[model samples]
Target: MHDDEEMLRRLRVDDLPPSMVDLNRAMRAGRRRERMGAVVAGGLAAVLALGTVVVVAATTGKNTAAPWPGAGPEGSRSPEPAPPLGNCTIDEAPVASQSRMIKIVANRSGQVFVMQDPLKSGNLLRWMDGRQERIDGVPTGDGYGTAAAVNGSGAFVGASGYKPAWVYRDGTFTVLPLPPDVSAMSMVGINERGDLIGTAFYWDGRDDTRAVLWPASQQGTPVLLATPAGWSSEAMDIADDGTVVGYLSHRTDNGPVDITPMAWGLDGSARRLPVPAGWTPARAGKRGPYPIAIAGDWVVGAGARWNLRTGTAEVVEGLMPMKVDKYGRLFGNVPLSVPDNGSTSGRPAVWVNGDVQPLPIYPDRPEGTLFSVSLDGRRITGTSYVTSGAFGTATWTCGR
Candidate 1:
């Protein structure tokens, strides 16, 4: 990714909010010698590799170097997966090698987008190895009805516009009609059953953002999910079982600002997951989860914290629970540490129950990382670069 230098530059500028401006200045005003090897927590992880499958070592006998528990592909010196409970791998590569710059989502299945790497431009979004589709009329940019979620068939792209949001299934954009002054809506995610979970707002959009479950048995107006008070919400990912999770802003009685993170579930009513106890003194914000599997009782998520521990949400610590293969096991905090030297303030480390393991990187720095475990307590994703390199938005999926 080419944005490290740019990330670093922006960190000095737009990275810190006005509230954090004083904190940044104070940290710099002090001497560097006092905090040279400090270890802070609560930062989000960024996936750095490009390819879908990344193997750094074989998973067999030479498990010494591999980060995973099983043997990797033949002839590949893979990082042995860690203990069964903590298996993982890391890989990072430049985005310029291949692939379009903008087509948006990038998993094994490809989509196209505008390329903006240095002198690159004019690239357009289209199907894999195909021509661009024509839209008779539509907007663009922040207000454009961008399709953020794809259905099981990949035929529909859930999109949103400045006005009503729509589901672009079967090549045509069908507006998800809502009755009476429904000014805004957008799709957040889809479940294995092809159900969509998202949000919609009114100019007087009720009290706050709503968590919407779509394909209404009958649609008069978009449904508003019950959420915690003062907890402004937006629906994010949805699980196969229909569990939803996202963020909420914490507030005081006097209506002042409070720490907020990717919040999931409501207070008391919803069975919210727990994080470190030090987050909020008033219990205004619940320890939000990412809804990984949502089994019988558990709702897992890429948990986020305000980091009373680190004093910054952009640089926090989290866990990547390992592959718990058998019973009576506890790998304990196989923590996913993040880069918070405050160099390039991109995203914070927010792995929920993700298994964290050390992987190959530039010599001399054990902290340089690139792999994060998913809350299934198994799957992993992350990024890595030697020399404490930079970041690009597309570089968020470089793990194996």
Candidate 2:
């Protein structure tokens, strides 16, 4: 690897921590914008049926092609009016105060979910129809609660208090059942089918955990995914088709955490996908470069996609993927940085047909991170940090 690439890889790997607490806090530094406590898979777009708002044609019963008073021909029509100039701007108010950090931003269909004061506020805010509503009375669990994932039906899953995992559906909270020997669990991703995937950890002072899958109907037996001996696994993202992706971390004889990529089938069968050639463990874990969004033919990571059938990999030259829309387009910020309050800021960019285009920045909010994009790729949400060091949850829309 080139010295620069190697250095970048080292830096990314070093930022990865196995603990969910530290990882959640670090998200403010431009990490994966998944649900509160889980890794991003962008599966809600598929399960939730989030269709974009379309501009319907304005039709009158009568034909209006007739030329006006000074016009030339009777059949003449003004050059078909140019397409509408879409509206794109940031939200007017910050989702939270400057003392709190907006960690998780997710969307289902057209509704936006923002976890304000993550791990501290436990406040889950939803935005729809230009208004914001907080799901009333969610357990914040000593202010350490974090949202893990949200499904299409607006159902939310996350870890709270001593149980470490819970689900909120229809305005009620249900504690997820844990294994006989497991004391702690971290719920991460939930598929449209309502199947939950996460990690089950024990309180026995061992760093061992197993990837687990729970059915939505709460009917079938919970599936505990098998991991290689001496390795601990955490289930991160789940696709609509029941595919699960996450990482495996194990200790070396001398002492260092080594990580690898893992995937599982709906039947609980497990397999390890090869990390892209020359990509080190750190360049491809927790935050990505590992498959987070899976569809019929593609498994996508931060800046790369692998074809399931041909097993070929295509890399986007210079984009770090944060989330993928239903169309398989990657959303993330570019490596380019701008100065903001004595620190560098990144420009949000999207990859379409492998070409990079930076998203428009609102004049009021000079620098922001783009985390969650609507399934249609029309709406996006993230935290915009102002020059004054104050940040708030923000959303942008095009073609609205």
Candidate 3:
């Protein structure tokens, strides 16, 4: 296996504490099992199975320096576009944990934020009223459950590694219901009305996955969103009006053939978002144009931004977009590549009126990524790493 693929497999499939020897053994065992399955199938199915493996490996690799999808609330709201970022100040927000923060999300008002520590302990920390407290209701196990998105009322939704997807509200946890023949599900984004969007995986092993919507009532069954016949879909973010945005990828015996941004309306109709002329997947760091967040008529992704009203997309140069607030301010990171060492670092930044304004980084914690931006464009939260390789959650409060 290639070095990157090997690293991704270890990170995604194995949750046990790191041990090089044990990880190697586990990889070998996994390969042996795949080989035996191929022998048992012994035909077209075998080829397709191998292709699916490749797709999973490619998609599962985590980009630590890029902002995760659904990092902040993007429910339907009037655009309160802010002026281009000007002179601002920066400071570190206090947190209760010393472990690495895996994900951070904020409510529409930015008054409440949730941070998850997935490395050392799987605890969800809620920051409000200038203090931090542990959220008590999320179920935990061997591995950490992801805290995907939160709404204005402080209700949040997420999925666990060993348990079903759930929503925590009013100091209680409620498990989301799954559709028939689906064994596993994950909730990624929730809107103001309590509508939830996520993905459902099948049990038949055809590698079938579909984007699903769970209504606000919590008792209603999830509705499967529409997709093309041979393609698979995953919903990343949902708007207050029930619009969902994500990506669709089609795979074959060779591998993933195409990946493009897509959206579903309130009626469950799928519409393909146009890409910039002459742009291709190879131009997007081999990941294609994956939409991470949607607000109003705008959808922002790694290196592309599309306007749903005009049906046009423009290239977002030098920015891996993480969050787009209702005010149209774009928050992201500029990845700095080190050619000699083949490593990459990021500088936290925001785009104002198509101009890039780089945020200040502390001398002690120089490398970091921006995860959540306040609706008013005043506060941004992310993780910063020290020279010793330890990281902590921080928030940068900016002002005029």
Candidate 4:
């Protein structure tokens, strides 16, 4: 694996809380499905070459790759059907050439914002009504441009270099002026009203980081969100209503770190979310419950969902809700444990009212992961790993 890819894998695996119970059952079912999937893997190279299927492969294979055990032609077991999304339909998005990987950063009202090549040479792309357009003119120093969030108005927030956060709107990239000392000022989330939130690092001797918010106009000075005493914080996401979600961690004398999930309001007020019941301490390689996405009345973290209205949090077994759409449908990955190696993998999954359903992967694809889901859950976007060893972006829409 490439150095960056290896680092990412380590981060993701390390982020998962320790293995839970019933993993054996889940693994058994997954292995059976994997076996079924392995049977038709060989024929997919042809389908991938045609590029006619919605879940298209990134490259054409040489037919030398070995299929899984019990291999056969396509339709050998009838591929798994897509999960139903009531009153919502999915439309596949076009894959851009040379786009090795994709991350659908945001979607609203059928308009999708995707960040192509999330790790290297990033480009901001938008999809709607069967047309895809790449927004040009994002600045870069030595590193590439990457977007973290988009608002309903089509304005996106990100950072170009260590010093300047940027807002891309209507084919223009505007610098978000900050103090000269601020570094690593990446915008993480934005709301429909064009309000944005992100973290800015101060390169003081301690290397502290704090959250900041920018208003829609981009005229006034950025507002710095509160950080607790002796704790450094990073704001990860923001809801349309201006609620910010992130984590708080303390480092004493550069020792072991402890993180606490946090939420901030429009007024810049901060509160620590109580750890859900039955929550266990993350093992040395695991991360504790940390909030990742915030939608109306809900905050999704590492292993649980917090209901802001009721002040109640529930544990989601085997799934960590990553993005919660407007209609409350949850999109994330299910961690799969391999009985042989004691290692784990993530399967793209969706949840409604605590019921989980794994998303379908193509016969030729080794794995898949979701990045964004539309408000009504009709559109889901993610990436699939093809047998040719390349990653391709995929969009799943509810169809008749």
Better of 1 and 4 by lDDT: 4
Ranking by TM-score: 3, 4, 2, 1
| Per-model TM values vs. the true structure | 0.47, 0.66, 0.73, 0.70
Which of candidates 3 and 4 reaches a greater lDDT? 3
Worst 10-residue stretch by lDDT in candidate 4? 45-54
Mind giving the per-residue lDDT tens digits that candidate 4 earns over 1-400? 4321221231221332222222233442342233212122111110001111111111112111111112244231112232455433233446452334334565554355556543335566665446667777777743456676776667777665453568877768887767447746756777778887877776566456777888666535887776655666778788776778887665445344566666777754555554555555541124555788876656777666665543445555555556776545578766543435444445567776656667766655545556666665667776666435475556677533
Q: Write the per-residue lDDT of candidate 3 for residues 43-154, one digit (tens) a residue.
A: 1110000001000001112211111122345432223345666676666655543543245666654567776644336668777778777876577632466567788777
Once fitted onto the true fold, the runs of candidate 4 whose alpha carbons sit more than 4 angstroms away are 1-91, 95-99, 102-104, 116-125, 217-219, 283-285, 336-343, 398-400
Candidate models: Cα lDDT each: 0.33, 0.53, 0.60, 0.56
CA displacement after TM-score superposition, residue 280 of candidate 2 (Å): 4.6
Q: Best candidate per lDDT, number? A: 3
Candidate 1 C-alpha error for residue 391, in Å: 7.2
Clashes of 1: 55
